[model samples]
Target chain A: MLEGLLVDLVPYGKAFQDLDHRWMNSEASFWSSGGERHFMSEAMVAARHAQWAEERERTGGGSGVGFGVQTKDGKPLGYFGINWLAPAHRLAMLGAKIGEPEYWGGGYGTDALLLLLDYTFDWLDVRKAWLMTTSMNARVMRQMEKVGFRLEVRQRQSALADGVWYDWLAYGLLRDEWAGRATLVEQLGLRERAAALGSGAK
Target chain B: MIEGTLVDLVPFEDDFATYLETWMNEEAWFRAHLWERREPHTEHDVKKFIERMEKDERGALIGFQAKSGDPIGALIFDHEWPRVRKAEARFFAGDSRYEGCDEVLDALLMLVRYCFETRNLHRLDAVALPFDEAKLDHLRRAGFVHEGTLRRHIRWDGDYVDMEMFGLLESEWPGYAAKVAELGLQPSGLEPKPKPEKKDEKKDGTG
Candidate 1:
């Protein structure tokens, strides 16, 4: 498990897989889909997980890697991972979700993202990390900026959500640009939370 | 086959496959066309590629031939269709002579028309490498808006290069068509031209 101040990137065990349906169908799904709300059956989620596992095995995890985000007490908050990786270019597209609504705006996703980036740049040896989100997602837009990712592209009116058209924004961060987790945690004012969580674990 | 003034969108055949084998081995042509790492493809690999294109349900690969019936290049449209109305358009000119020419734009206009009109797609997306100035010009002339650039996204030769993204919506097509029309590029008359079977029959009879 990859450790973080607020969350740890854990393996997707049976328990986490059991909540896949709920998380995918929840309000978080809207953000994940870039504004499209859709329902997914347990069977469908199972099939998707199976496909991801098969793909990981086939590519020897060179393509992508996913992880379950959990708290110190071992409570799963959501999931995050690199959606795609281009080894030749040393670049990866990242994705994450704090499925539990109570965790929203609480920095859980931020900590998880920082942890994921650590894994991506340090372990994976990727040069750049990027992701795409809809313009309507203000939280993500703000988080990406706070995390030091540059808004590289804006595809205007590319996504339609709830009868309204929103631009699809792509954000990219280079390895050298990332101020490591400790600095970022301090920069985002998450040091207190990190401290509190660190003390609580003792 | 969708016929235009200078080029026709033909189905994938052995002749086009042969042309692709030659183009795939050309370093400049292959690098300009795709982001995949440069590696020589064998005849067997080319055959497998054609088979994959034929079997792919979510994409269409069509070759464009000059009025002289010479296979110049191919265009590909990939999408999930009804599930996701947006499609990605990729095209390359195997014959350098047609690069950024009227014939290339003609083929693009035909493709845009087919995607928005016949296929009823909502949007079309395309990408071009940084050094592909001719392709960038063609995309702009074909009415694709420059969306954004992904920095150092593509591996070219041994170094990384930027990838430019372009998109066009269905609602924007009419305006673009009119603009191109004023420039004297006719996007009309996309009816499939009937093939001259006599030529094929004579060839088969003689050979």
Candidate 2:
């Protein structure tokens, strides 16, 4: 579990299923421009939930962890997690989506991201985290940069979304780069937790 | 088999496992070129790898000497994106003599022609470490444009190394092909262009 100022990231559970299904089905969710906006059948959503739930039980705290991003009052907002976790190389891929349209543009998303990065870098001992988004997503691109991710590549015309060709932007953040921004990271209220982890945490 | 002047790229066969094992087991080459850990090589391991590649439907070929028929290198096309008609290429030269020679270029040209002209791929991508100037130069000479840097992308010898990404689009091949021919790098048997005669003139009245 990871607690933040506005959100808490918890392991996948039965409680997150409804929100997950809605998020996956909604056209306004984060994956809208990626051509996955169509509503999935209830059975398909349930099956997906079951698969992820089993995965959480197996590797949640070990290799990879999927979290349900919720409010302090336990109001579910979305889901996020690190997939393709390569602990051997201290690397992982970041994936997240805030399904609740009401929470759009709210600081909750950024807070959730900060909390996730804190866990990934400090506790998970991961040295690198990367994410990819289509060039059309200016908002997410700006948010990623604001949180210290560096633009690594603009894979030209890689994604064809909505009959339009869009470049896929790959962004990566290294542990040392994250460590150097101590003052900024501290402002996220993760300093105490990160310090408690100590140097050997890596 | 795609035949070139110096080498022919034959579809990888089960019988070539011994040659591949010998190539991969070269400690110096693997240390300098590859990112993964060097493991003990055996015929069984090579056989399993061949089977896996076959099962995955990967494009793999063994470059053999046209004269001696000895395996000189391997060319692999991986990370296929059928929807986008693109793939990543990995080329390893087993013979050190071919490292900085025209034979390497011949093999590369053949592969590029096959990929873009025959297979009709939209793009091909390759990567090299930042310090691998030789390979980077080879990529440029073969008409691959620098894409971007993958920062601290791979662990090499216990330290992270930045990888330089390069890409070649099929649309750019005609221009590159023209440049190669104009530079006389094109293989023999293709009719060479007649060289323009130099006009000699007196600059300071000394003919």
Candidate 3:
């Protein structure tokens, strides 16, 4: 059994899970809308959205924060969310799924992961974050690093990918150890976010 | 819109909602790339990604914005892989009055200034699918060097798709900028070239 390479840690929404059910299996990826193996169905996407809603209430999180992804034309694509978030722990698990494989490796999976990391530490005051990936997902390992996750542990032959056991890679990061947060803030034009803070402020 | 002019790896987290917006941006990027590859990502997956990013700062993201008053399609200097200190110069009509994506590489020169000269970065690089002949040609026109291909690097449609990487060194950028400047807006349009003037029809018989 190998660790998962999913970009988000939260259970997927109906749309997202649909993506997961499709891409999680290598064979189903062929019927993807983008001619890529990474597309999901509607029923699968909603389930994850439910979890996201639950987590928001438990954490005083906002519903709009529930993340959504789509192409420029506004086509629903995949979904992501923060799971197992511990305010005191300053830690949260991130996860995402793209049913349309055409968009796989297109930078969204990794970029979306970084987006959440940006939110938790700066405004949310979290200290750090971590994630897990299967040894079979070398591409995912690279993607994890691209978003700045460092390997924390490697469970030897802990999981299976193709009837063979592979090591699972667990990666994490601290706020101070992070790079590009300030630039992203500036990039996002949110310097005045100070005025936007507070649960009821919005 | 505080467009991306300067960029660096950001460790600080973004607001939960803002992070969601960033995820939307990623979705757009993925779609653009998918169009090149002839596909798309999960439709709503990108927005979910933004929310997740709001939870932590494991992977620092870059910021991009266009300068105010700079033509919407004129000056688009954005960082792609800032670790490589590179930014993108986009020029798209987007189903509007505009027609093509020709000025993409040419617009990059101004951004190269912002990166190398203003930001004090060293080198810049860009990637293009070999199938995206238009984009690839623009890079070549902008004086970008064809570095090499990773070959079947990206998994697409149950298999891997070949990807080509191109690079433009800081040292090479200055001369290229000069070449483009000398031409002024003479080569403004990205449309395919018209037939050359024939020798018999030459106005000054210089041919």
Candidate 4:
């Protein structure tokens, strides 16, 4: 399991299926509003996990790494992952969700992002990370901006949601920016870790 | 083979793998354009590559000189989204001799037509390094509009580089037909002529 201040990143398996199913059937739609929402089944989630396992093997440990975000008491709250990874280039794409509506607006999502970004830049050795979200996702946009992601571009009228067209916004953050977020990096002790990694420290 | 003006896209064969390896690793502009390390590939690696291409739904075609049948490059339609009917097109002119020629455009035209007409795709898109001005201009002439730059999207030569994205919808193809005609971008031997040549020339009536 991956450690974090507010949550732990646990492996995905059959045990988490119930909460994952509920998440997908309900709260997940608001996040991926551009796509047609449908009922998700355990079989589909199992197949996706199997695919991720194959991808990890294919990329030789350089591809997607998925995890279930859990609380200190071992309650699964949501999911997070890094995909489309190019280890040689030190780049990857990131995505995450805190599916439980009661958990929304709490610090869990932000903590998950911090931990994931730290893992991406530090452990994965990825130098840059990026993601795309719909223009209507103001909550996610504001949170990402706080973590130093810049609004790079807006793909106009790229998505159709509820019979309306919306733009897709692309955001990116460099390792330097993450390291320079100052308070968060210091609070997470990532600054010292980064310095040590630079000087070949563990 | 998918025929074009100067080139034909032949189905990729196992024997062509080594040649492709050379082009990807030894070609002049390979490093500048491809955002990856130039690692040497063994025969086993080549075999794995061929197997993956054979199994992948994404189309991979080898560009060959229509007249001489010599391999020139590779054209790929990757990241296909069947639900959205969109795909990303990528090409590398391994044979540098055709860099500035219209052969690349001809090959692209053939591929674009196949995607829209044969494959029934709604959109075709591509990404280019910001430094690739010639390719950007070529895409523009082919009616692809600039979408936006992905800031620091790729790492090339130990530095971060931005990628400029371009897209073309099937609805826009007709407007680009005129440009294609003006450039005579067609199969090599099919260029339209103003008139047939006279068999005998009258040299000021002195012949």
Model 3: CA > 4 A from native: A1-66, A181-202, B1-207
Error of 3 at A198 (Å): 36
Model 3 compared with the native: what TM-score? 0.35
Candidate 3 RMSD to the correct structure: 22.8
- Model 1, A106-157: lDDT tens digits are 8888988988998999998999999999999999999999999999888877
Q: What is the lDDT for A190 in model 3?
A: 35
Q: Which of the numbered candidates is closest to the native, going by highest TM-score?
A: 1
lDDT of 3: 0.47
Q: Relative to the true interface, what fraction of contacts does candidate 4 keep?
A: 0.41
What interface RMSD does each of the candidate structures achieve? Answer: 1.7, 1.6, 17.1, 2.3
lDDT of 2 by residue, A1-202 (tens): 7776566789767787766667777755535335434567889988976776677678655456778888777888887888668755677888878887777666667777777788888887888888888788776787787788899987776666666767777789998888443455556444454344331111
lDDT of 2 at A157: 63
Question: What's the CA error at residue B170 for candidate 3, in Å?
Answer: 56
Native contacts kept, each candidate: 0.68, 0.38, 0.00, 0.41
How much does candidate 1 score in TM-score? 0.90
RMSD of each: 4.6, 13.1, 22.8, 10.5
Residue-by-residue lDDT tens digits, candidate 3, B1-207: 222222111222223223323333342244234323333334256445444544533222223222222122223233434333344443332212222233334445545555566665545555666676666766677666765554333444565455565656667766544756653533233332233334457689664
The DockQ of each candidate is 0.58, 0.33, 0.02, 0.34
Docking class of 2: acceptable
